[model samples]
Target: MVDTMALLLPFGRASRTTSPSAQHPAAGLPADDEVLLDAPDDRLGPALVAAGQGSHRAAADLLAATRALGRWDHRDRYVLRLAAFARSRPEWVQTWYAAAPDDPDVLLLRAQLAVDHAWGSPARAELLRGVSPLITAAARADDRDPVPWRLALDHARGSRAGHTYFGELWEAAVRRAPLHYGCHVAALRYLASSWHGSHRECLDFADRAAQDAPADSLVQALPARAALAYLNDGCGPGVPPERLHAA
Candidate 1:
C-alpha cells in the first residue's frame, strides 16, 4: 500500500517553511473591541435584522437565491446562522413554517434547529434518532443539495449509527458535492468517533482526502483538522512529531 504519511510530508514541510505573513498577509489578533464573532455578511446582515423584527421573508428570499444559484456553501453557512438565531428567538421560524409548510428553506432550517436542540440533551442519541424524519424531509426537499446530507452525517454520528449507515450517508453526501468541505469534516468526525483509538486511520483518511482535493479547496485542511482531533483525543497512540507537523 502507498504510504499516506509520505504523501502528507511535503505539505507539512511546506507549511513549516512558509512564513505566516506570506500565507496570510493580514493575519493578526484583533483588539477585543474590534473582534466580531460570527458576524453575518452584508446580504445576511439585513436578513437577520429583519428576522429580529418578526420577518422571515428576507431570510427565505436569501436562502432561495442561494439554492437557485447552486451556492451550496453559502446556503450551508446561512442556514447555520439562521438556525442559531432561531434557537434563541424561534417566533419568526415558527411563523415561516406556518406560512410555507413545505418550503425547502423552512424544512432545512427546521432540521438544523431540531438537531442543534437534540445535540445538547442528556438523551442525545435518542433525541438524535427521532430527528431522522426532519433530516429526511430536508434532504427530500432538494435532491441537488449536499447540506442536508452533511447534516445527516452528523446526525448519524450523534445517534450512534452503524458503520454501514454512516458509509451510506457519506456516499450520498459526496455524490452531491464531491469536494464539499463541510461533508468531508462531518465524515472525518464520524471516523474519529467510530475509531476512537485508531488515530492512524483518521490521519490516513485525511491525507487521502487532502491529496484528492484541489490546492485551494477547503478539504485540503482535512489533514490538519485530523491532527488536531488526534491531539485533543489524548487517548490515541502517540503520533510522531514529524507526522503531526506534516499534517
Candidate 2:
C-alpha cells in the first residue's frame, strides 16, 4: 500500500550507503529512522520523535494538517509510518483511540493497522472480511481521500471479491484521484490476482497505467513490478527475458 512491495528495503538498509547526500540532500541531516523512501520530510522527523516518546498528539496533529490541506500523498506516507510504529509500540495509538475514538484520522490509522494485522493471519480472508467496517468507517470519514479506497482494494483482493465488486471499488478510488499511486498499484495487484497466470494481461495493465500517469508518478514503476512478480512466480510460462529487460 505504501509502495511496491519490492521497493521496501529494510528500515536501516538505505542509511548504510555512504552517499546520503546524493540519495537524499537535506538542509539538515535527518536521523537514520527518519530517512524514508529516500526522501525525508521535516514534519515527519519531529512527529516520529514525538511518537517515540509515547505521545500520539504530534502524529495526530501532523495527519490532521495533511488532511486539512487535502495532501493525500503526505497522508498516505504518514499513515504507513504511523501504522508501522503503532505495530511495535501500540500504547500510544491505543491511548489516542481511547481519547478520540471518532476522530477520522485515528480511524484511518486503526483501519490500516487492522488490515496489516489481518494479513498475517491463517484465516486471512475471514479476518479481512471482519475488518470491512473499519475500512468503511475510514472511507466515510473523508470522501476526498483515496488511501482508504486503496486499503479497500487490498482488502477486496484478500477476501477474494468478485470482479464487479472490485471494479466498483476501483472506480470510486480513481474518481477521487485519477492517478493516485497507491490506488493504481492496488488495482494492478487485483488484476494479477483475478487473472492468475495471465501475466501478459497484468503486464499490459501495468504498462498502460504507467504510460497514462505522469513521468514522476509511481505508476510508472508498476510495469517493472509486474515483471518482477512474473520472474518470482514459476507457475506460468515466465515473462520473456526481453520483456524483463524492457521493464
Candidate 3:
C-alpha cells in the first residue's frame, strides 16, 4: 500500500550480510532469537524485509537504511522483503497484489507465503490460480531458477501425478545439497510421497548431513521425523534415514 515497488531497487542494493539483530529491534524476541544469536555474514535479508513490511518496524527501518547504499551492490531486497511481508502479513499481499496484480514476482511470493502460513487458514491453491501464469513468466524470466520450493510443493500436494513429476527434481536437489539445506523438508515430503517413496534417500541425506552438515545443523531432528513417517506408513520397524545413512 505504501508504493513499495519503487523501493525495490534499494532493497536490491543493500548488503545481505548485515546483522538482523542489529537491524531489527525484535531480534531478541524468542522467534527472532535465532536471528539475533547468530551474527552470520549473510542475514535473512528477504525475511527481514517482509518482517519490516508486515509489522516489524525495526525491519522496515533497516530496509530503508539499506537504500542509502549504491544500487549497483543491491541484491534481491525488495523481492525478499515483499516475500517476508507476504508470509507473516497476508493482508499486505492482498494490498500489494491489488495495486500491481501483474507483478509476477509479487504473485509468486504470495503463493509461497500462502502455503507456509496455511496450517490454520484456507487452502492456498486458489491464490495460485490467479497468479500461476505470472509465476510461470517470472520463472521463465529468471531462466527457471528456483523461486521457492513451496510453489512446487503446492503443486505436489494436488495429485499423485504431481508427486511423480517433481520426484526427479527432489532427488537431484538432495544430491546437490543446496544453500538452505534445511528446506530439504519440502523436497523430502515430495520425495517420500512419490511412487517409489524411498525413505532411504532421505535417510541418506540425513546421514550425509550428519557427516557434513554445518555446525548449525539444518535438519538435525529430521532423522527422527523420517523414521516416524516410515513406521506410520508401515515400512516395518523401519530404519530412520539418519541411522540407515549412519550404518
Candidate 4:
C-alpha cells in the first residue's frame, strides 16, 4: 500500500509556507482554453472516427493489442469508451461481432454495453440478471483477464446477489489481477451498497486493501474513495479529520 502520509508530508509542509500561485506552473490550474472534455487519446481518436464511419476494425485491433499486452487498465478504459460509442451507433459493433463472434474483445464490449443499457431501465435487477450469460461468456473467454470479472462483480451487485455469491466473484477478480483498480472499485461499490450503513466496515476494507497494495498501485486510492463515500452517505458516524486527511 502507498504511504499516504509520506506522500503528502512535503505538500503539507509547503502549504504553510507558500502561496498557491507560487507553486510550479504545471501544478497550477490550466487555462480555460486548455481544457478538453472527453477527448480521446491519439490512438483512440482514429478508432473512434472509424467507428463513426461504420467501421469496427480499428477499434477491434486496438482492444486486441491492449489485451495481448496484458494492459488491463487500458483495456478497461477502451472497452468503456467503445461500449459508449456502441450505445449511440451500434452497427460497427454488430458488424464486428458478426465477423468474429468469438472475439474476446467484442464479447467484453457487448457485456459492458448490455450492463449499461440495463442500468437505466426501471427493472434494473431483472435486466441485469438476464445479462449474466454475456458476462459469463466474456469471463470464460480470457482466464487471465480481470476486466470481465470486474463486470461480473458489478452484475452481481445490480442483480442483488447474496454476500456469498459476491464474495465468489470478488475472489475470481482479485485472483486474476490483485492490483487492478477497476476490480477493486467494483468490489468497493458492492460493499458500500450491499451493506448499507456499514461505513466502518467499508473503511476497514478499503484501508486493508490499500495496505496490501503497492505504493504506485491505483488501489492506494481506495481509502480516499471510502472516505468520500462515507461523507456522502450521511448515515455514518463522523470520521475524524486526521483520518480523513490520511485517507
Model 1 worst lDDT run, 10 consecutive residues: 7-16
TM-scores vs. true structure, each candidate = 0.82, 0.80, 0.47, 0.81
Can you tell me which runs of candidate 3 are displaced by over 4 Å?
A: 1-89, 100-105, 113-147, 162-164, 171-177, 193-201, 209-212, 217-221, 228-237, 240-247
After superposing candidate 1 on the true structure, give the runs of residues whose Cα lies further than 4 Å from its correct spot: 1-37, 193-197
- Descending-TM-score candidate ranking: 1, 4, 2, 3
Off by over 4 Å in 4: 1-37, 193-197
For model 3, residues 160-235, the per-residue Cα lDDT tens digits are: 3354456544543333334333335554554462433566665555445445545555445555555555656765
Q: Write the per-residue lDDT of candidate 1 for residues 179-232, one digit (tens) a residue.
A: 777787777776783443267777888888888878988778888998988888
Kindly give the number of clashing pairs for every candidate. Answer: 1, 0, 7, 1
Please give the lDDT score for candidate 4.
Answer: 0.75
Question: What lDDT does candidate 3 reach at residue 220?
Answer: 57
* Most TM-score-accurate candidate: 1
Worst 10-residue lDDT window for candidate 2 reads 8-17
Once model 4 is optimally superposed onto the true structure by TM-score, how far is the C-alpha of residue 104 displaced, in angstroms?
0.4
